[model samples]
Target chain A: MAERAQRKIPDSSRRSERSRRAIHEAALALIGEVGYAKTTIEGIAARAGVGKQTIYRWWPSKAAVLLEAFLDLTGEAAGAGEVGGEGESESEAYAIPDTGDLEADLKLVLRATVDQMNDPRFDVPSRALAAEGIVNLELGTEFVRKLLEPQLQLYVRRLTAAQATEAGGVRRGVDPRIALELLVGPVTHRWMLRTAPLTHEYTDAVVEYALYGLAPRP
Target chain B: MAERAQRKIPDSSRRSERSRRAIHEAALALIGEVGYAKTTIEGIAARAGVGKQTIYRWWPSKAAVLLEAFLDLTGEAAGAGEVGGEGESESEAYAIPDTGDLEADLKLVLRATVDQMNDPRFDVPSRALAAEGIVNLELGTEFVRKLLEPQLQLYVRRLTAAQATEAGGVRRGVDPRIALELLVGPVTHRWMLRTAPLTHEYTDAVVEYALYGLAPRP
Candidate 1:
């Protein structure tokens, strides 16, 4: 088996890249199937058809492996949003678009989030990880810090830009961090709890309710 | 064991009540320790020191048992809010207070919710069930319909009244159902994710941002 693997990839750089991708795929699939608690380095390496040392060489821990795997998954979605040629930076593509209409921009982004959350490939694995996170405080904090918070930070950036925009900006005093949570928190609550249909209409209502005061407009 | 239980309660009614309470407590404890999937009818009965038939006689399934158990736990918190001299209805106790000042009323209730969520007895068992619910759609849906939605409906009732009230009410077009999610959702998200400290100050800020438009007040 080792000889076959080595023969199939004569170039070490290409061989390493192949092993990394396989490990990520194996990690995601295993975590989704058996759950985070049961998924292990040996299992992942066996599934990926690589030595356990290969996984260890790339990641210090299982959590780190899963973290990078999720990042890679989200990165694919981000990369797809790029209109620029292949050479464009990854970060710019993942940004919440500044369409100059803050409300519209937010609604658009949230709608896409609804779509992503609904997709089984994303939703199933995410639910598994999120479920584990809920019970395991250390894992939960790491999931938030590594995966969820970075995505949230995008909203923070967009909202902050809206604050400085010439027109249709948020009020000066509103904390972008907390304000961003208003958009994210509600959608997440519904999604996680399975309380309501996560439709575009629902997300739009959230955006509208959030932007305009719930109280009567004076 | 049965004879001793009967001797402890000469009245069958009192005996049944004791058994029911034990079953509920056992279900909660088991679910907290072993989680929803691993928790079973036979296990609950063994832990509660009751016959399997006794649990099934009271609850149709393990899910039903756990649901009632959680309701019982939260019901204690709800019951404590009552001030009447013993004749008050249970539903009345759970209602969000309508003090004519919408902001104050919301903040008060949300603060109470924060307190409930932080309690280890409530928090630990709740997190376990919630974690299970995240991955288990059937349980998640059942949990929402039976427990969460009813609690949320209190917000709906309050918001609907606010719309009709002469002072400090919501706007005419705001859908109370959707509007209530903004309040419940963010707090739930913070509690479940442990993204930040779920404090009175945070909830108050949520209430303020939610009531006032995130956009600059025109």
Candidate 2:
């Protein structure tokens, strides 16, 4: 009886995992198509081919589902590189590379950012969420707290490490927190405003200009 | 008869100007109240106490009305400082001051930006418009071209002048266009994201960090 119970438990857990993935995919797709204001738990459940109660059982709100969906998507995108080697932890996939070259490291991540921003899969849904964030202060704060700041902190960590290294790339007094903004902010502005096309070339230019200073270096 | 006709024409022109101002004010108020999607031409016309044809004659669409309304508001804001001098041209209001000190000039402009972003008269309608821009690319591009890029170019020109005046202050090879972003991007990021409060102090910090380099100057 004990052996039978153990076997049933693994099957149930696998089924639950499948259902969760389906719900996340459904939530992302629905929000992309209809936008945040119109997306609902019922809609996600319908699209996922599951009952609404099953969705409710897992997530209390559409916002919660969408948030997790984005987190999952980011994880998957980060996992595409060699960081996802077998036996590596999940956190490894999201880790920003630390090569001790601040400029090159920033450029590499930003180039990947350019790709992600341009990708329709990411862009459409992100725009939907961003539009909602602009109007909804509560959701916007939650997004910054949960999604954006965590990613920004990875840059902060890298910059802090750069300061400690003896190579002397960044100035000692520079605050890594604000320094990261000089790198990330421009790309974000171009992306959000559609002022220009965001490309790897553009991202590379931002990194170069930021590191070298705009005033002619004496 | 010719003199009488000319005098009558001026009177009619003066009346038209008043009506135009009323329409602009109405458009801003309505957009702020109902947001972009719900705001309509008929609504603006009603609020302005003008016929739909009058608004149609002046603007092609609601977006056009809102954009021009904002332009008119900015013009008024600029002219507020010009009250004592009849010789001041509209161009003077638009020009960023070149005080031979880049950091001071940047701080002045960014402080103005902080004030503009915080002003309820500007913030509510601007937020409504920005939210729409996030979702509508064609509209977003048009809005940025008509309203934002002109303002950004002023910074580019000022930065270029700074580079020329103080050769060692900015790198010669730096693109002023991209370089200006390093200054403006962080301010906008903080404002739009609400990650921090927008203040003159924050603007000063951004200018200092951007121009001087985050690293302690050698």
Complex DockQ per candidate: 0.72, 0.55
lDDT of 2 by residue, B1-218 (tens): 88777774457778889989999889889877877888899998898899999989988998898888988877666554323345764444576776677777778888988898899888777877887888888879888998888778878888877777655366677788888888888877877778768888777877777776654345
Off by over 4 Å in 2: A1-10, A81-93, B1-12, B78-93, B166-168, B215-218
Residue-wise C-alpha lDDT for candidate 1, range A78-143, written one tens digit per residue = 655534546765444478887899999898888988998998878888888999999998999998
Ten-residue stretch with the least lDDT total in model 1 chain A = A82-91
Q: For residues B1-218, what per-residue lDDT tens digits would candidate 1 score against the true structure?
A: 88787775378888888999999889888888888889999999999999999888788888999999999899888766644445765444578888899999999999999999999889988999999888887998998888988888889989999999767569988989889888988898889999889999999989988998689877
Top candidate (TM-score): 1
Instruction: Tell me which residue pairs clash in candidate 1.
Output: none
lDDT of 2: 0.80
Model 1 DockQ class: medium
**Tens-digit lDDT track of model 2 for A80-121:** 653756776554447677777777778899999889989988
How big is the positional error of residue A185 in model 1, measured in Å on the Cα after superposition?
Answer: 0.7
